[model samples]
Target chain A: MDQIMSNLGLLFEFPIVNLKIILDGVMIGSLFALAAYGLALVWGVMNVKNLAQGDFVIAGGYVSWFLVKTEWLQSLLGVSDNFVILLGVLVAFVVMGAIGWVCYKLIITKVIERDLFTSLLATFGLAIMMAQIMNLLFGSDTQSLKLEYDTLYFADGLIDLPIAKLIGVCMAAGLALAVVLFMKTSRMGQAIRATAQDSRAARVLGIDTEKVYAFTFSLNAAICGAAGAIIVMVWVIQPFYGITYSVRAFVIVTAAGLGNLPGVIAAGLGIGAAEQYGSHIFGIGYQQAIAVLLLLIILIYKLLRQRRLRQVLQ
Target chain B: MKLKFATLALAGVAVAALSSTASAADCDEIHLGSAISLTGKYATNGVHAKNGYEFAIKKIAENGGVKIGDKCYNFRVSYYDDESKGDRGATLAERLINQDGVQYMLGPYSSGLTKAIAPVTEKYQIPMVEAEGASRSLFNKGYKYLFAVLSTSEQYLASAITLAAEMATANGKDPSSVKVAVAVENDPFSLDIRAGVLEDAGKQGMKIVIDEKLPRDLSDMTAILTKVKLLKPDVLIVSGHSKGAATAVRQIGEQKISVPMVAITHCEAADVTGNFGEFAENILCSTQWAETLTYEDPIFGSAANYEKEFKAAYSEYASKKVPYQTAQASAAVYVFKDAFERAGSLDKEKVRDAIAATNLSTFYGDIKFSDSGNNIAKPMVLRQIQGGEYNVVAPSKFASHKLVWPRK
Candidate 1:
């Protein structure tokens, strides 16, 4: 009857949409991964989730927005508009690094080895406090940076990249690569990585593991701040949206698994794109629902797989 | 020594009795139970409502509380935080009614929470004074005990269509080709608004290009923004979480989408808190009060004063530098006190009937309950944030300035 054909119609229609969904998922997933890599860096090193990671990004973005609109950077440094972005990224890096250093030296350092729960609670508390402070300092409002890069147009309208998004993607990629290079090559980065794997072993090998941990946490925060600056080029930054970004980061790290930077970056882009495509298919109402569903499925799948292996052993 | 001790004991007894009579003669201390959301998402709305009540209580006490033929009663209030949750709100309402034995109660910040606690109020026969609630079903349930100070979501969203039609003509946009994309919150108030918007769309010849009811936590709106961009609609009307609306605004900006935005309900309030000064321009929204009200407004002239005093007293309680809930709360206090005074007693039925007869002006507005115990037709004002202030811009008469349309 109509039910069978309508059900059959979906069977025919789902493949075309399935491909589109996957394609869309990959695009948004990558972006989620990128944002998550920032959090993962902090988590893997200092064991702090960086609750204010998204806000730091948002604040950096507002700074960049001010730089672009008021051309204050041009006035201050006599830099061209082309150099404003580079200046913004550098500025965000230093500012966020300093903030991280202060936050750690004063607050986070005292509670580092207390317990996992303490760190989690402290960071989450810091996140809310920082959000309110941001509201007080800058107010609860949307701020963004406008760029002049032209949109990337493709045939068949399969992919149309916004100029700002293209720039954000490139900046995020470049920063993420720089982070990878530092982790791989730099002496401090090596010490941090060593400490992440084993703090006792790192200390035995003549590394000041405490310093490395603190620096790593700061570096992670700085990277997230830079990401915030970059993201505002493509997305809106709000004071209260730190929680959403944190959730997005959590989903990415969990979905892609830990320590996978490229996968993390891919997850961010994939999430952005999935939301876009999912909204198109299901009407934007179920966008968050889809992400929640994906996260739940993956989490449950992992749990079930582990259970099955346990059963086999028994 | 025994005779003197007896005389002194008698004197002490007389002093104790005299103090009791003196305390009774004041007859001014009236206890009110208030259950409001003091934290979480509903904190801002609850704090404001609480402030409105506080301001009214202060105003009344200064005017000798309330006069009931001869006796005047001063007000004292007790409150609990609902945390913006339905179960918690109902639990608090029960405690306020059963435990505290308050004759009247104010609050239940949202429709979900209000509806959850409505039965408790009915069971207790406590005349509940409602403000900032938007669910119409609360009134339609035939609960004579329930009363509201404002119109519900149905009337709120119906204004949107009328606004669109009126705005298009005034702004030099073609009314014939006006397209509205309704992106309302998935909440009950928003759902009702979405329905009303769709219902009125055909009448105004308003084409609904995108009718979307999104959840409050939609952080990734790229697809929705991209679709709305592709549709190239002239006007985008979003009705949802205030923070969500603010995010939509920033997303629209990032995409270089230059369409005028209209938000309904609490989203407008969120727009104020989320957008702040620089980015608050040109986004039209409907609200109960405009911060930039004239001297005639009961609360507007004193808003700055209230802000200063409230911050001094309840600094740890509230943060945002805006007013709405305070007016609702303070005025409710005044109304409750005035009505109780008119009724001449603290009896629940008499107070309910007196509250029903509230027709005069107060600190918030001229509030009067209809036969059904809701505001007869309390108006919703359309305001836009300009230079960090919410300016009234619609109904022409209440407008502080002419409409600022999108340049494109």
Candidate 2:
């Protein structure tokens, strides 16, 4: 308790510390928002809650890490190391999309329309399988790509921002923007949105609902993979680290209702900041606990709101 | 009917004679069992430890196996993946004992896993010679059947604390004026490491600027690092297994955390110097064994030879230094072999007594278990990573290189 109070006191004594905490939170939160956005898409369209969402992110990280480790690829491209590292994001995006399609055909298609619990169990199993397979293929060691970029320091270095993280955030924002534009203007995006609205109605209106579901699922996987790729450059990734990302993604998606991209982004950033503050004050041991607690608070709040709405109808 | 009966008896006698001759050619096997972390967080070191056990077993076999009275027996291990969870480890321990009927046991990877398995082994009266678990709590449990080849956890970073105080006094400053920061994982091994630091720091009357426990799935510790920056402590101590060491090195570099002295555990196991390059320079790492030590035995020749042969046998470790986790694990197996030979019997109680009375010298270190089952003869060494190589700098007697003060 004394440590917590003292830590809290430090924040007040030096308000600049708060800025540092928030910056760190927001930088990490952007990645959370990226993963959560993919979860939101899959849940909104397929009604299939992806428990393996974090594994997809980690697998994508491995994909990127592997590419960065390939000396031949860097030499063949005749590009700088940073450019090759960034290229991993594109490669992961495409590879994960294809893997996502395979997963849809093999597992998701079987679990689709078979109740929510069934999908959850299937995806949970998938998460374990993927984690183990990755562990086997790539040794269960934490891996990251060290970017040869400088950190921009501010406030006398109290608040320092790494160029890699800055690029990651920008790329995430760019990806989200591209996704939004695709949903707004593209014909396939229109079909996807239509199928998400009413699958039976879309099928009756000459749209292939099956194709839309597969595409949406694949797209979600691609988004998660790209996020994982960015994460590898900024942070670290391990075979088992996927569950933490999965938990954060679920928290963000739960707090922000399905199909609400803006809400998901806001919740992701908010939760990230909240967790950092919790850890800063309480200690880093409570980091995972804080993430789980936020999830519970959001669930209870939503439940209470629903109950009040039901009472009003009565 | 009489002719058929005679033929059957003759055939049975022939079979028995053939089986006895075959058994004479091949040595009898003494099956040992282990529940080590083959998957999950501890897998990296777990695999290393497993390899250590296997290497020792092969070496023992080539040394003509364990001779018991008039019989010779070779060691064969049945291993189950514990997945790095305590509860899962306990369950597998039970399976190894009850289902597999394994009477002798080898210890699991980390102190956490060993803590979980120790109780199960104790309940079944299985004698376990563990190498990886170094938590002081395990020794204090008064486990008669359990013996550890490695030094206890408190000793891991205590020398580093003493060194920090020595450096403070050397600079003509009071040791009491030193400020310390500690960040350790919230697991058995790391928490015990934290406790040791707290105790040592308290004894020195040094102010603790920051003391925090890292989360289990630890990725980022910028929050704590940020605090370290603000406080500017003289010494920073960090202990997590391989992942923690890797994360700390990477983040400390990225965050540009500048402290005079930064000490951590598991540097070799985490390959911090290989991964982080210059960023890992001057950091003190606590290790159970260093190959530079002139420890030797007949089976593995010498510590340096063990490293060479191990790298030859397991090419995966050719790129990096052979982790002490692997070296100590091999030592544990050697202790078991010596105990079995001393007992000269397959009786579990006799074997247990022999293990309790263990006093041997091997490539890893001197092995003399106290009544509490921890090796008391060996001292933990602190090595500084200088120029991408680990050089022992602490305890003065074991110092292969001078201490590089004030890491830059």
Q: Taking the tens digit of each residue's C-alpha lDDT, what string does model 2 give over A253-294?
A: 999998899999999999889889999999998998898999
lDDT tens digits, residues B1-408, model 2? 999999999999999988565553478999999999998878878999999999999888877788898788889999999999999999998998899999999999988899999999999899999999888999888898999999899888878889999999999999999999999998877888888888998999999899898887888899999899888999999998777888899888878888989999878667897677877889999988888877899999988999999999999999877889899999988998899999999999999999888888899878998998989999888989999888889877767899988877
Q: Clash number for every model?
A: 45, 0
Report how far residue B219 has shifted in candidate 2, in Å: 1.7
TM-score per candidate for chain A alone: 0.86, 0.98
Fnat of each prediction, in sequence: 0.37, 0.63
Write candidate 1's Cα lDDT for A107-182 as tens digits.
7887788888888788888888888877766665455554556555443332455666655666766777888998
**RMSD (Å) per prediction:** 9.4, 7.3
lDDT of 2 at B236: 94
